[model samples]
Every structure is written in structure tokens, then in C-alpha cells.
Target: MPDAQKMFERITLPRDAGLPVSLCNVSKTYRTGFGLPVHALNLVSLRVPSGQALAITGPSGSGKSTLLHLVGAMDTPDEGSITVGELELARLQERERAAFRSQIGFVFQRFHLLPALTALDNVAAPLLPLKVGFDKQQRARELLAAVGLSGRERDLPSHLSGGEQQRVAIARALVNSPGLLFADEPTGDLDSRTGAKVMGALLELRSKRGLTLLIATHDAGLASRCDRVIELLDGQIVSDSEG
Candidate 1:
């Protein structure tokens, strides 16, 4: 197996490549069991520039996750269009969408690590589906170290602290060298102090990699750290402001 340094050398992004996201009158709705219709997003539209961090802040049912899902290609909007870089998400075929999604990184509120796998293994798992040319294990190890988990590569999720576990998740997200990162309430599972550490690591990595970041959170403090913030209410954008 190649060493971490050698693996790191294989991870590269084009010097001018950065994904800018755009949404145009997007909407999503769900049908309830009782035959009621619930609007998750209603004609929402926004744009995020390349290499910039944007925060989505809203109340519990304000459709923040719905917006993230559409932008991340996890779900398609019921109406309008979503564009990430040059790809129109709603217009993509299954195969093309799968290919496009592989270029994005996602971190959730829960650290969805496998309890049976070591941190290194968890990070390397995502690369198994892709045709990456480098050693996934070494790349995972390097990502772990980059997130301040240099010596904890072998630690299981249960053995690490909350902050450390989140760090591991971040490393796993970055293992594929994604140009865009989507985080949905990434710090919601931790205490304030631990959350701060995780958020700091995320921001540092974004700066280092020039990644386009979109984070959905209720934390005002965390939102304040982003380059811009958009507030949603009742599935509609209520305010959009620069930080």
C-alpha cells in the first residue's frame, strides 16, 4: 500500500475548478398519509459562488433539509431547476446523477460511522464504489490526520470523543476530494465546545481545499461564521444576508 503522503499526491482538483450552485424557483412537496399535502420548499431560489460558504438557518420545519437535499442531488425538486457547476440536477439521468453525486461530500447531524469499522476503514469505504486510482486506505489516513486525528486512524467510532468522531466524519466526507460539501446540522449532536471544534475543522478544511460549502443549521453562532446566511420560514426564504 502506498503511504499517506503518496496517496495525498494523487488527490487533485483543477486549479480553476470550483462548483457554484444555483437554484431557480425550486419547490418540493410531500403527501401525507391522511391525504394532506405538505410543502417542504416553495419556489425557493438562491445561488452560491465558487469556494464560498453559505449557511441555511431556519426553524424545525422550515425546509432547510429539503433545500439541502435538492442541492446535493439526494432528491429532486418538484419544480424549477437546480444547478451545481454545469450540471442540472433535475435533468440528469440516473447514471449521470450518480456520477455527479460522487463529486459531492455530505456530512449529517449524526456521525453515520460503522461501529464495526475503524476510523480509517469508515473513510475508505466511500471510495470503494468509485474508480479512484489511488490507495483509498492511505487517502483515508491522510484525511484523518488532516482533521487532527493523526494517531486515531484505528479507533472505532465508539472509542472516540464526540468532537473526534465528527472530525472522522469530516475526513470521510473529504476522502473523495469533493468540490462541493453539504452539511446538514453537522454540529447538532455535540455540546457547544465540541461543536465549535468540529465547525472549526470544517472551516479550515474548506479554506485549504477551496471547497464550496453549504451548511444548514439553527445555531446563530455557527451561521455567523459563514460568508453568507439565508433564513427560511414556512418553506420560503425570508431573509438573505452577507455575514
Candidate 2:
């Protein structure tokens, strides 16, 4: 198997930040060659308003990650519809989908920084293949400052702490100024203190940019930090309450 860091370095899949999202009776099933097919999501319906912060809580295989993937257009549902902002996902062609994805930012548990790049360069990687109006390094610096990594721009991934590296990943994800952000266990690898700081930065940016934020997490403390929380079980929503 390939090293996770090296794989990310090679593919460099840049993701985006916020859009009001809607899904209607969406279902996704994976058919393994062996026995019963696994149902990742089943008739799941949800609507997230623009600029809202929603946390999804569930045990493993409860479809939290699947929900995010479907909503983010990283994967498609086998049934029903998904709409983000003004666009319907299933209808978008390949090129259009790529363009749409560029406008959305995503953060994951793994930092995925290129081993060869400095912090500043890592944060600016997403912008290298696109045409943007802003200066990349300046944007990266501003984001690093926001995440409290001001003096660490020249440091490589190996030289930084886990928290700082994650922050760099966050900056890279947001380089396109996406309208929606999806975080899948973003703080799963950090200690409580570091995790809190990372979540704080994310919420601050979400509020500042008016981005809709969706976080999937096992930590109740982290889930409570959002404006609303939804619990999932067996690929279905079981509870949705205010944070």
C-alpha cells in the first residue's frame, strides 16, 4: 500500500468551503462480492441553510462519512437528489463537477501535507493549478495567523506539531474561499487542547466567511460546539437538536 502522505502529495485533491445543501430520500449501497450489500445511507433527507454549523454524531458504519461524501459531491447516491446552492449534483457533467468541487473546501483527520513543502507552500498548493485573483502566499500567511501558526511558515511538515500541520491543511482547503466546508473527524488526531483550538479556528472562519459548516465527529464536546447537532444510526437520522 502507498503511504497516505505520499498518495495525497501525488493526487493533491483540493476541496472547497460553503453552500446551502439539500438531500431528498438519498440512498447509497455498496455491493461487496461476498455476502449482503452494505447500505451506507438509506432514504436520508436533510436540508442545511447557508451559513449554518451542523455536527453529525454517530458510531462507526452509521453513515456519517457517507453523508458528507454524498453532500460534498465526492460520491453520488444511488437514489434521490442532492442540491447545493443553485446546482443539482447528479446533472453536472465531469468538468462542471470539478469546477463545482473547487468552490467547496474539505478538511480531514489526516493533515495530508506534502513532505517536501514548507508550511506556506503546503497551504498554497490548492491554488497552484487554478487562476485566482489573490496572492497565494499572502492568503496562506493570513490563514496561518488565524490558526495561530504565524512564525511557522517556513517549517516543513516534519518540523511542525500535529496541530500546526492540521491548520496548514485547513488553510489549503480554504484557499479557494469555498462557500461550504465539510470536516470529517478533523480533530481526531489531536489532543483535547489542540483539538479545541482547531475547532475554534474553524468556527471562527465559518462565521467570518458565512460558510455552511458540517462536521462529523465522535467527540460529544466537539459536537456540542456547533449551532446544531444531528445523531445518526443505521444510516438514518435519529436525533437533531440545537447545540
Candidate 3:
């Protein structure tokens, strides 16, 4: 019988239209509580394509969070380089770093919402550092409604449930329409059902807006939902598999 199909693999996809993030030999070290040097990331190099949802999965203390921080330009690496698009983070001044951060959205497991500020104000905080005025308020409210928090816009973080708070954080992250979105254990604080809902919201954003995503999580189920999973062990990538 004739061959029915070719078994060869297809060509690798070209890089996305715009650069999202690049890390070259990045490493980070910290002083442990016992005063000994602890390696968080060791010569880790990675490139996150624009509009791809990538997950970094590892156990606690495996440097996943540290990597996320570096990618988002929230913290500088102790060694090597991290460049987002054409901007080299290490070479930029503090003010420039802050500006770059404004272009990236970040979500944390702790929610990190202000106790005094309403959800609307919390989402509007990122715009405060920028000079863009008047429109920021409207943008914040719009984003909050987009994340399904329309009725709870005036509620404080303390009044919102864990899932609601995470959704609010998502709105805050997207308020600036950041080119990159970083979430560190975004669903770790919620129950399984709520976690799934939050993950759905994130996936929806990635699909609708072409947002680049880097999610750090220990939940295997959540990681499996991403397009690719990079597994880390002892500050090193043990496996990178496409989903």
C-alpha cells in the first residue's frame, strides 16, 4: 500500500512580529537567612516570543519567581543581561526601568491590592506614575468591567473574595495594555473552581489581545493550559516541552 501520510515534523514557527523578552546568561544570588549565598538563578537564558503564553513550572525555591521578576524588569539580575525588545534593562537608568515596568503587567499570588483603595483606584495606580491624565480613570473602569468586576468597581480589596481580588489584579495588570503579562502563582490563592475561572480569564486575554504571558506556578493543571511549559529544577531548566 502507498504511504498515507508523511511522518516528518513541520518547520519551526518564525519568531513573533515583535520581540517580547530576551535573557542572556542571567543569574541571581541572595544571602540566605543563615548568611550563606543562595543561587536563585544560574546562567539562565530564555526568549519569550510575543503573543505566546508560556509557563514556568517548578517547586518552591526553584527560582521561578526570580525569573519572572527579571523578565518584568522589576528586579535587576546580579549577572548577565535581560532585554525587552530594544531596551536593555541593565543599561537603563532607574527612571527608565520604572517606565519600562509601566509597559508590563504583573500579578502576584498575594493580590497586592491596597486596603484603602477601591478596585478602580488600585487598577488606576500604574497610571499615576505616568503623566497621562483624565483618560486613565476611564481606562481603569473599562478594564475592571472587562475583567467582570463592573459591579464591584467601588469595592475595596478587603471586601472582595480571593477570586474577585485576582480578577481585579488582572484588570490592573492590563490597565496599561502592557505588551507582556507576568503572573506568579495567580491561582494559588483560590480554590480549584475559582482557579480554573481565573485561568480562563487569562487565556481569554491572551487569545483576544495577543498578550505575551509568563506564568510561574506549581500547579501542573494550570501549567498544562499554556502553549509551552519550561520546567526548572535547582535553578536550571530540566525540560521545555511544547503543549
Candidate 4:
């Protein structure tokens, strides 16, 4: 683990004054089954400005997903820090981290929706923890409509197309109005046409809501659509360029 202060110096700060998300010298290492150490991330640093979208691209085992977990606070780094908004994630307690994570929406490659739950219920899952003033069901319905699933609110995952299910997942992700959205292989299971639709929904969300988007994927076409493309190799970011 490198010293955070020193690693901070190495990161080139973006021009944006208030980047919604940042990672400084973030590293995560694990022991392989063979007892050899594997470095999933090595002194990785990044800053995603507010309302910007960044696509993380790499070959398999290149630590793209690991970087997402770090930024999403699903896991802590072995070294360095990740900050979201004004919050320093490394300094938060476990409960606080959980709460903070609720403010971040995650779309998994597998959808991860409950088979028994309808699209509406699936989208409402995040609001269970908030207990806010609004009606969760009403909010979920609105989100589903926004994603073009207005008539399928009662449909279960089994009944929807891969694209539709993914849209439901996106609605679920945005139900909380999260400042950041983390998507992993968002269109991995769909055809090119369906994938384009999913990307369209994401792009619409970015432009309409100004939501910051980070997608971890191996798809070059998808990565090229984002505002910036970051390449990961051997658990390190080798290149980052504007798209």
C-alpha cells in the first residue's frame, strides 16, 4: 500500500472543481488459489467530473470490476482512498459506508432482480432503506415509465426481454436519484440492437438528469460512447483518453 498523500501527488487533477467521484492510489490485492498474490488493482487513480461518464475497458482479469467496487464502496482498497461527493469513503464507518452506498446505484451484468418480484417491486428495492416522504411504489412506477416500461410494471423478470429487464434494472438504479451510477457489463447479454437501446437509456439518463456514469466493461463499442475511455491492463490503468 502506497502512502495516500504521496499517491495523491501523482494523480493529475482534472479541470473540474467538484468531481463527483475520485480515486487516489486505490489498490486491491488478493491471494490466488495457488497461494500466489494477485494484484487486482495497483495504485489506480481517477477523477470523474460531475455529470460525466467514464467507461473502464480491459481484457478479462484486468481488474475493471475491482475498480468499480472500489468506487462504489462495495469493498475497501488495500491501499489509498476513494471519495464520493464531499464524503471520504475510507474514513466512513461500516454503517455509514452502507448508507453512502445507497446513494450510489449499481447495475449488475446479471440484472440481480428477484424472480418473484415484479419490475415495479424490483425498482423499489433501494427505497426500502430510505423511508423517505414519497411513496416508493409511485416513484418506482414513474421510473419504470421513464425507462419505457410503463405497461410492464407488473411483469416479472421471466416475462421480459433481456433489454426490458435491463431497463428495469436501470430504473431500480435511478429510483434513488443517486449522484453516481455504476454499471457492470450493462449490455453483456443482449444483441447489438438491444444493447444500443440500453445504451440509449443510459445516455438519456446522463443528459437528462446529469447523473455521473461509470461502466466497467470489455465492450469497445460501448466504451467508445462514453465521454472518456480508461484502459486497464494487469490491474493498472495504462491509458485514459477522451472519447
Better of 1 and 3 by TM-score: 1
**Angstrom error at residue 207, model 1:** 0.9
Instruction: Judging by TM-score, tell me the better candidate of 3 and 4.
Output: 4
Instruction: Judge candidate 2 at residue 66 and give its lDDT.
Output: 96
Worst 10 residues of 2 by lDDT: 7-16
User: Taking the tens digit of each residue's C-alpha lDDT, what string does model 1 give over 1-243?
Assistant: 444333333333332445899999999999899978889999988989898888999999999999988888888888999988777777766656666666688999998999999999999998875556688888998999899999898888999998888888899888778889999999999999898888888888888877888999999998899889999998999999952
lDDT per residue (tens digit) for residues 1-243 in model 3: 211111101111122332377889999999988999988999998888778788899989999999998877788899999977677878866665656676678899989998999999999997775554369889989888878889788899999989999999999998767767899999998999999899989988887766888999888998899989999888888888852
Kindly indicate the candidate among 2 and 4 with the higher lDDT: 2
Question: TM-score of each candidate?
Answer: 0.91, 0.90, 0.87, 0.90
* lDDT of each residue in 1-243, candidate 4, tens digit only: 334333332332232222388899988999988989999999998888898888989999999899988888888899998888877888876766666666678898888898999999999987775546699999999999989999899999999999999999999998867778899999988898998889889978877766889998777887888989999999999999952
CA lDDT, every prediction?
0.85, 0.85, 0.82, 0.84
Ranking by TM-score: 1, 2, 4, 3
Segments of candidate 3 deviating more than 4 angstroms: 1-19
Q: Model 4: which residue pairs collide? A: none
What tens digits encode model 2's per-residue C-alpha lDDT throughout 1-243? 334333333333322335788999999998888968898898998899888899999998999999999888889899999998878889876666666776788999998899999999998888886555688889989888877789999999999989888998988888777788899999999999999999998999898766899999999998899989999998999898952
Query: Ten residues in a row with the worst lDDT in model 3?
Result: 4-13
lDDT of 2: 0.85
